[model samples]
Target chain A: MIVIDTWLYGELASYAGEDAQPGFAQLKIELPDGATMQDLLDEIDLPTELRGITFINGNLSAMPGKQHDLTQELKDQDRVALFHLRSMWPYQYRQGAAMLDSFNDEIQKDGDRGIHHAFNG
Target chain B: MWFLRINMKDRTHQLTEVPEKYKKLAGRSLTSNLIADEVPPLAHPLGPNNKLVFSPGFVTGTSAPSSSRISVGGKSPLTGGIKESNAGTPWAWKLGRMRIKALIVEGQPEDKGEFWGLVIGLDKETGQPTLEWFDATEFTGQDAYDVYPMVFKKFEGRRVSVCGIGMASEHAYGNAGVIFEDMSQNPSRFAGRGGLGSVMGSKGLKFILLDDAGAPGVEIADKELFDEGRKKLAAALNEHAITKPKGGLNTYGTAVLVNILNEAGGLPTRNFSRGRFENAAKIAGEAIFDGVKERLGEERYNHACSPGCIIRCSNTWYRKDKSEHVSCVEYESDWAFGANLEIDDLDTISELVKLCNGYGLDTIETGVTLGVAMEAGVLPFGDGEAAIEMVHKMGKGEPIGRILGSGTGTAGKILGVVRTPAVKGQGMPAYEPRAVKGIGITYATSTMGADHTAGYTIAPEILAVMDDLDPLSKEGKIALSRAFQATTAFIDTSGHCLFIAFAILDIASGYQGMIDEVNGVLGTKWTADDILELGTEVLRVERKFNEAAGIGKQADRIPEFMHTEPLPPHNVVFEIDEETLDKVYGEL
Candidate 1:
């Protein structure tokens, strides 16, 4: 048996267990050995119309969207984060920090032809 | 398209051909370019030398969604720099439909203290907007809460889109703003920053009412191409998780951000004393939603503030008597009045927002000013009622009220509080810079003073939309904030609401659609590079203007307290190096 700890956000929290609070749900999925991410999603009975971003072991599970990548196997004590209809922002703005080159790589990963505008120094 | 120049110096107005250089400008770009070119950079903001200009966005008045933003610009009395504050109101669409490219109000009237109004509408014969002057003595000295309804009644026949400076502006308060209507025509939306309204009031112009009924709307060169782009953009908005039906914003409005930021440990509390508010849940979007659902009637929640905005993340607050208490309460306003002041009650926060709206004050500025006063021992931190009373006293012109009305930095100076949370003389927003490090780059470097809207790095830093750049790490934010500011500068000129960034950032079709729509209308082809160039040009013009105004890299900094005083929860201080900060405008 494999147990995956998951945190669900927005409306996706309903399919999961009780939430600690809004946008923070604590639940564990008990999956049979060799069960894939899709199998776990199916067990959770998540809505098909619902599109979301998932994090497995603290990394993005799907690049394009959803849990359709069924071959990815679940593991014991893995951390999974499911977010549906959630958009985070500065509840007007939070600041500080420095600049990095990886920032441009992350922008490219967002898929809209990465916009990491640079200034000529 | 024509530029309507109103010379208050001689009580005359003229419609002239737009200068060739300014033919393609709109919104912030248009306003900044004009101010940089025409107005003296060193002119006193409230003096006759400063010119106040109003312009609709390039994409306004057409089938474009959320394109009804109107930018009001001039020398900022608050920042003493070139300023442009925008609002989502029907007046922008009205002006666009009337084929007016820009409306310029220049020079102070000889009788600067007298009240006056400018009425503009489509001429029956000419089918273009013409200006008419009127004596508005009756509504003189009244706050926007009292005067907006009167203007609505007086121009009921013309279906005029009205917005005006209020008593705070009449007092020439630097913290004042211009207030206008939502879709329901309640004067709730505002161009609420840098005190441009005071500039208008200084010119003795109390009200500006525009009517575009029976006039041709925006001229689109390629109708089919434009339609395709509009449809693509709308579809993206409808499909996005945040912008679509039953989205977090749609369900609870922008105040929903409270929990998200709280969980991130970035919500400022008690005037930058802490990053996380202990009672943040009390004013969270879910709590506000539950209140609206339990207390307010239908037709009050999930309302639209602009003519054709799809997101409609605005809501109204109603009292037990079922009377509307406030028109639209947003997240920053809620955070400013609620957590920043240690006022936990959502109802009281909404009431305080209404109080600022009534007085025509910037809620962020008002809250920051009040926070300074509280730090200085003017009032107790948790006293919501006292805060309300102090804002109400703004129009009375009392010494205390004037000090408060002047803004946060001034209030802090008078009260001997060095911990004023401001940059470039403008008060900080709800976000705590120390905790969310990326936005510190924005506050320290934005052309506009402490303006989050100038460069909303929240999407990448906090939301993890495009990139999950660590909010705590100071490595990637300079490039990140510069990108956001440039993209946002381009978006601001497009006339669409900044909220559309959610769609454009993630969806390729949406980004392409935004480009196509502008290209279709103007009959010009532009790529991402061209778009970046345009934004850079606008920033350069603004930078030059600020330089001439004597505000330079030395003034582009966060408050000193942010450097020495560490915010709690994260226990972080804003430490982005000044050398990196200077690089934000390096290209320009």
Candidate 2:
């Protein structure tokens, strides 16, 4: 199961229940005996441009390709955190091709392949 | 016709006449046009080639209420582009009464001499400008009273206006601003932006004094016509709940917006990362007021930004420990330093305000720069003491300090911060443009660089005066933003306090009648059409300049995060399409 928090601004908050609760929602997943992280993304409705720099318990981890191997080990109690956008400038999305090009090398350096090795085993 | 020309090289001076064409442009319009014409865009901002100018607005000399505005213009060390920032203060009213439309100080001296000041006075009857130079060391570490009276004594009760810089400017720091003494003899008012102080220092001028003793009063074509319009306009404002006597603004000042915006959840925090901050109540208007009342024991918490301002949305803050904090701790500054930096301590924010004031910098830009530095981990977020120390470093012209002082754009580059929240090399104010879509258009399109006050679409879009439109919807926003932008350019050029926009928009004929009064004063026939045209022209000129400067087209954009990170509370992203943004400039 995965949980997400949404904090709206100005007048929009009225739309949420006045109690200001997290308005929790959950998604349940069933994986093949050996599934991968990329498979999890393929199942969700997240924006395509959101990639790079995933944090697990506040510590940045290896690439999605390597992290995907964890899909098999995932259970009902596991937690997943995602950052939709990498760049901070507001208004536009779609990280520039140049930005993505460099980020690929960073993912490899951060041991994305090793994370995949864990799930693959 | 008298003008004083100080040859900075030799510490010598001459008196001259105001050119005919320049007589029309005053305040921001005059100063900006002057800089654009005279200054080469590529010239080093702090070099001798750049000129410094201070001018009052078109209606500044008239007895119209709240018409006093002072404009400062020079090459901006912060933006590396032409910058003009106007501030409202009683000094403008006093100066305007002397019949001085503008003051121009130009050229550096032959010898690289020590710092010197100049005083220019009128000949009482002849109204000719006279120049006197002050000793270089007399004004160091002194307040306006200490230094100003000495210069005024030279004029002998001539009712002069004194414009000078403090120690911060003499060092030629990029963030340095020039202080103008108000009628109350307080030096708190400043023409603070764009490092105009650097331009003054570059010209080797420490001060430019205006003495209008012999000058005639500003001419009005028809007294009856002007008065009728003025009375109606004034009544509209006076009767309004917002602008009237002892209204919300009167009690709380601009700090009133702190709670309202926070309640809306648009109060930015943690360097624009989050929409809400837990510390809003601590630094809110009511809290700020209570703090002052307990500490100062005075009923006078509110003060007018300028003379004749009926809406007193400005205040003097006192530390809880019973010491002077800063006069006029505006809402934007409160958000920029307090909530944005994750520093909820009001006293610390006050200290930062004082630091910017004495050092001669824009509080918004300086605070935003510090926030960007925090984002880069140059300093930890919410380190209020470190922020104050960094500002002090700027006063002394330290290298890292210079980068921070230059503004958020350069600071982000220097520190390698990816979360550089800015538009066109200038920092955004308190409102997260994504939250307020209409204001977002303004942040993208304003020629002055990401300034919210540049064009306020919030009134029409959110407040819903003429039409109640969903703020989240993108329909009619382009037209709304353009209309508001055009109207604001006219308002700024007219030298009227922008808060008046609220009253004017609400009252059917209030805005038009004010325009009529200005026409009556100027001896010209102008209707609403003329005012709108003037605004359009100003925008056109700005767009042309930006296009020529190569910041056009591609430069107008919101950052990538807005599109991807669906802001919390409302899952809505910035729905305004990029194609629509380009259409805004289509007419231009």
Candidate 3:
């Protein structure tokens, strides 16, 4: 088994059950080896639509209306943070920052090169 | 319609008709142009030759939503360059309604130790602007929070608003900010950057009070067109997710960016040594919202900073006993004291913010200076109580307090700290340039030193200015940043809040509405393309002034530490070459 240290922020903190604090919740979930992000979401019972911004080990993996990280496999002892829909990261503030290869590809394929305040997919 | 000039050297004033050249300009464009035309470039920033000018935006005082913005411009004592700092408040709305195009304060009193207040109102019989001078010596060397209410009470029977400086300005601190009264009469709103307040203080001016009773409101040249434009922009503001009622900003405030930037590893922490703070969530907007609910026994949304603002994003922090501690704990202020100092408690951060407000200091500059002081071992990181003591010293004008009050770059040099995060003598804000390259380019090239608002692109259509270029490439990003800077200049001149960019960028009609409103007021035909050109002209004038003042292109480069040190998590250095940095202004 592999352990994943996960953080839930804002309203999504309720997903951690009794471990939830006022603004955030942290949990160490024991996941079977080779489990993917989808499997971890199923374990926490969090719908993909509820997550706005997601990070895996400090690299942006997903944003609102963009959820390419669901199928990405999780690694052992990885740090994952999930934020609710109210969260936002403006394009200028995030431009040229680190992101997953799949996420980068998804952003580049957009018509305006992803120069938007929010993506409502 | 009139340029109200107050000569401090003689304690006299004059009202001149607005020149044809300046009739079309307002806000930043008007202030920068007036300074360029009147003031000598080589004059001392705090000397008699330097002039401080204030002007409202184009649509200000009209029924336009979120239009009560005032731009204050002068040669900066901090950057030693041309500077325009702005804020939104009822004072701006009153000034616009009085039909004063620009209020210019020039010359200096020989007895610099004394201060005087100026009362401005409209004459009931002549329908002309009037000015009255009063002794304000007793109000000097005191907290602005205490002074503001007294001024309001003295003018209790009349409709009035106040603007003044605090102890920071009286001491001639480089981080001093010009304080304006918010809706609640708190001296919380500020034209808070570039040390313009010190310039006012140097002139022996303490406050400027406006009483706009029986004054004419802003005249719209084309009422029908103006109403059409106003409705379009208002509808866009109401419909957008980030700006609508109960939207992200209204619900959580600007501090919502804390966690998002932390997740992206772009949040500058520990004197720019790291990219992420472990305790960021504790001081974030989400935590503020929840913490307030827990303390107050109810859920409270944010309130507007100005009178007509719809996208109310200003938040207040309450004490444990359900009393208000401060009116706002913004993102830059929160990050500067929280992650930058490695202090995460909201109470400590809010206390520091309130102290800066009371002292009339720019919170970003104060916090950044503290971060550098922490790195020098003056105080240890995460020492909240120690930080509070240091801020009190600043308010008291202690020796060490004066050193830190000289701003981030000077404090870094005085304390012998090597890793200073400054550009052109001004401290960088919350964003880490190493992790975010585009903003890095902006920080390097903006006429204003390291300003985040210098290049804010609202809509994708404005990206059309960079036709056929690949935005992913280095050259493409430079072009995009240039276009953004130009469009932002126009928005600043239009007198609308930058938050309107969020809605206008998504809704095309909203963008048109902004232009239409400007045209309706000014009675001119201006298209989207004309906006880019007009904004470009503003930048050109500012660059020319800075160059003549000896802060040429060489001073536009980023700090040496940013280019050498690697930020954590992402571990990226600012790799954009020098030649590319030159292209931001070179192509213009």
Candidate 4:
């Protein structure tokens, strides 16, 4: 249940152990049992240049820049999405996004190499 | 009385008369026709069952501008399908002037013993390729470029066109390419890709050198009309900054497309997993130039792929350590191996580019295949050093390297990676299809497997060649792809470079000059419309052969991963409907 705009710090995954990492941040605050959206972005050193609408459970949120509450009895495998800053009219893609996406990783994880040969199917 | 056939099995050669039917077809057209008529689709690509043919266009060796292209045809080891690849070099024109219509090299070695090389030179008065034997493979594995000078000195320093296979090609890797000596005695130009060099290597002949010393200029029916046409076309090319000397191409070459495509959000990074690379600017053409300038000096930046090329969009680059990286890192190679690998270091990509070239392999194919291998975790993604090691293994003919060298399709099978981005067993180029829809259609429909240069719809899709359509929209791509593919076939077959089409096709008179050259050389009366018909005929013949070889409507479809995965920078999957893909073959 982590959310950050992709373009802000994509290749910085190598800096996972740095001072700005979630737990190591000076402003880090544990979410309340029923804390709301505004409590999230206020805690971490989120990049200010990230601008766009945010999605929660596939529904668009009116106030995207503000944080949301996530401690509301969420399931272990609940999916949360942060729409990266990108163009979405004709098509939507993240600037500086990795070429291989989540779905590709899923299929790659499954080791289904024969999937391409079944194109006619 | 002008036919030459080299039988690789017995190390014997024969000279006979070419048939009348073949008189009309030459260059790209001749290559494709020979592949269709002679090769069995089911035949083992590396076995003696397949045949390799080389033919220059009918107008080749003429004073006509840009009339020095050669065509290489064979059943491809990479795609497991038929292919006819074309390249620009003095060799084709040299061979054509000798009235040599075609060179048919066939059969594998009977012994499967040690390898051999073919040394060819002119007899001074006759412009024909004469054969000699070289034991270069026995000593240092010297290639055509290295072997030619020694033999050329023996022939009194005569100019010759030599084609040879390097270490990787002799190993029959899918990415292996045939290297041809340029006018300056450099083995820089290649009839590369589609495993054409492997086809040559399988024939037991390491090289096919052409020394057409007394080659006569091509005959044209109307000299004045042709000259006038050439004058008009040259002037128009000079007018456009893109085609003119010192333009974007001449200055930065195709590598300029790196920054432009990144800004457009079409650059494929990390094995088609995303469309954008964070460090793209670090590997930008300008940065690469700066790196080279700091090391090799600025004078080394400007180069050309061949002689008589107006647009010198190529360069020889060096690393910050002042080491030679690659001679010419074009735009596609930069993106295909650079951003696509998630290794934004230009120097690393440059070094890998040289390794592929020196080993006689296609940069695009090797890059894309390596991208898939990274996804498979055979080597970690963005591991530039590991990728270079794998490429080196391919040169040495190692087993794992062989599997990867077969291209993405086979590589995917060997390593368990399902998200292999390719079409028809051939690897995709720089642009991710999900970002650029028109290019997507080109990949899906081009007869040449997953090739971008075959039908570059990017101009019409993004730059607006005639009508700019939204790249993501499926509308009008069918028509655009067909027209572009047909027109490309015409240009490729005419022995002219495709870059000329960008400026020439836009101008009415400039475009007509190419058609005029085609008509004048063959002595055939034809207009622009006839060119379309001839192009369409070429497609039909190729398609018919594919069908005969068991590649049907099913084979033309794109890989499943592209349709299923949503590429980022633009979270869009391929939106082109299947019916549109099927409709591409409608006219043919």
Best by lDDT: 3
lDDT of 2 by residue, B221-280 (tens): 777777777777787678665567665566666765564445344666788777667667
Q: What are the iRMS values of all candidates?
A: 7.1, 18.1, 1.2, 14.9
Off by over 4 Å in 4: A1-121, B16-18, B121-129, B139-156, B296-301, B321-324, B457-475
Poorest 10 consecutive residues of model 1 chain B by lDDT?
A: B457-466
The Cα error of candidate 1 at residue A45, in Å, is: 12
What candidate 1 gets wrong by more than 4 Å, as runs, is: A1-84, A90-121, B297-301, B457-475
Chain B TM-score against the true chain B, candidate 1: 0.96
Of candidates 4 and 3, the better by lDDT: 3
Q: Model 3 captures what fraction of native contacts?
A: 0.69
Question: What lDDT tens digits, residue by residue, belong to model 2 across residues A2-97?
Answer: 322222212122233443221111244454444444555555533323332232321223222333323333334333333211111111111110
lDDT of predicted model 2: 0.62
Residue lDDT tens for model 4, B1-588: 266787888778887677887776777677888878887878898899898988877667776565578888888888777788877777777777777778888888876544676655545655455678765445224434455566456556655666777777777788778887665656667777788898887776776666665666566778777776666666656655456676545655666556545644578888888876766756766555555655665544365565556665667777666765566787778887788888877778887877776678788888888888888777887888998898888767788888888887778777877888777788888877777766777777767788877763212222232254322235455655676676667777777777776456335566767667777777677776676667778888877877777776677777777788887655778767788788777655
Q: Write the per-residue lDDT of candidate 3 for residues A32-109, one digit (tens) a residue.
A: 999988889999999999888899988888888889899989999998999988777777787788889898898878
Better of 2 and 4 by DockQ: 4
**Candidate 3 chain A: 10-residue stretch with minimal lDDT:** A112-121
Write the candidate numbers in order of decreasing lDDT.
3, 1, 4, 2
